[model samples]
Target: MTIEVYAMLKDYFEKQFIIKEQITDINSLKEYLSEQKPEATGILRSCRFAVDDEFVSDTYQLKENDSISIIPPSSGG
Candidate 1:
């Protein structure tokens, strides 16, 4: 699976990465990423996930060719 991170997440992790582990859903992905960087767990827990440009639920199934975007909270005026 192709993982793309944005905002604060990019500061902590690579902008993009590929994972071969059997990650079946967004929730699992979150856990995996958190384990990779324990310090980012708080942000990762609040991050939103998108698949192919569409926001997805935690249970959303993942596909090998799918691009997963981890979008951190943002603020604008």
Candidate 2:
């Protein structure tokens, strides 16, 4: 699976990365990210996920080569 991260998330993993797995569900991906970057766990857990431009839930399944993006919440003046 290939994932693209934005904003602060890029600091945890590369701005874009590839995972060697046939299927990577949203929840598993979140767990892996939090494990790898403990510092970003809270933020990652609250963030929204999109695969191929459509938002999906934690149970959503992802196939290899799928393009995923993580969008964390934001606050601005």
Candidate 3:
């Protein structure tokens, strides 16, 4: 199964990118993110997690071919 991963917060200062990962559950996704970008650890903790555009918590279960997005706090003047 494939999952679509999107990053929102990090895009402000870095290149925005998406990931197409073969994974089964949220835990695996977390592990994958940790490996791909260690710097995202802190942001992940505070960021809002979502599945298929619906807001969810870290423990939310992910299904096959699900779309997941991490949206970090946004600030502007």
Candidate 4:
């Protein structure tokens, strides 16, 4: 899977990267990411996910070669 991260998550991960783990759904992906970057656990848990530009839920199923985006909440003036 190709994961594209945004916002503060960029501080921890590259703009995009590939994961070979057999992650089946958004929920599991979150868990795996949190395990990889414990410091980003809270943000990962609250972040919104998008697959191929379409927003999905935690239960959303993931497919191999899919392009996934992890968007953390942001605040601006």
Query: Could you say which candidate leads in lDDT?
Result: 4
Q: Give the C-alpha miss distance for residue 64 in model 3, angstroms.
A: 1.4
Worst 10 residues of 2 by lDDT: 16-25
- Those runs of model 1 whose alpha carbons end farther than 4 Å from true positions after fitting are none
* Candidate 4 runs further than 4 Å off: none
TM-score of 3: 0.61
Q: What would the per-residue lDDT of candidate 4 be over residues 1-77, giving only the tens digit for each residue?
A: 99999989999899999999999999999999999999999999889999999999999999998999999988889
TM-score of 2: 0.88
Residue pairs clashing, model 4 = none
Segments in model 2 whose C-alpha atoms lie over 4 Å from true places: none
Which of 1 and 2 is the better model by lDDT?
1
lDDT of 2 by residue, 6-57 (tens): 9988777799988785556999989888877999999998999999999999
Q: Tell me the tens digit of each residue's lDDT in model 3 across 25-50.
A: 66666777777777776666666767
Count of backbone clashes, every candidate in sequence? 0, 0, 0, 0
Better of 2 and 3 by lDDT: 2
lDDT of each: 0.92, 0.88, 0.62, 0.95
Evaluated against the true structure, the overall lDDT of model 4 is 0.95
Q: What is the alpha-carbon lDDT of model 2 when measured against the actual structure?
A: 0.88
Tell me the lDDT of model 2 at 63: 84
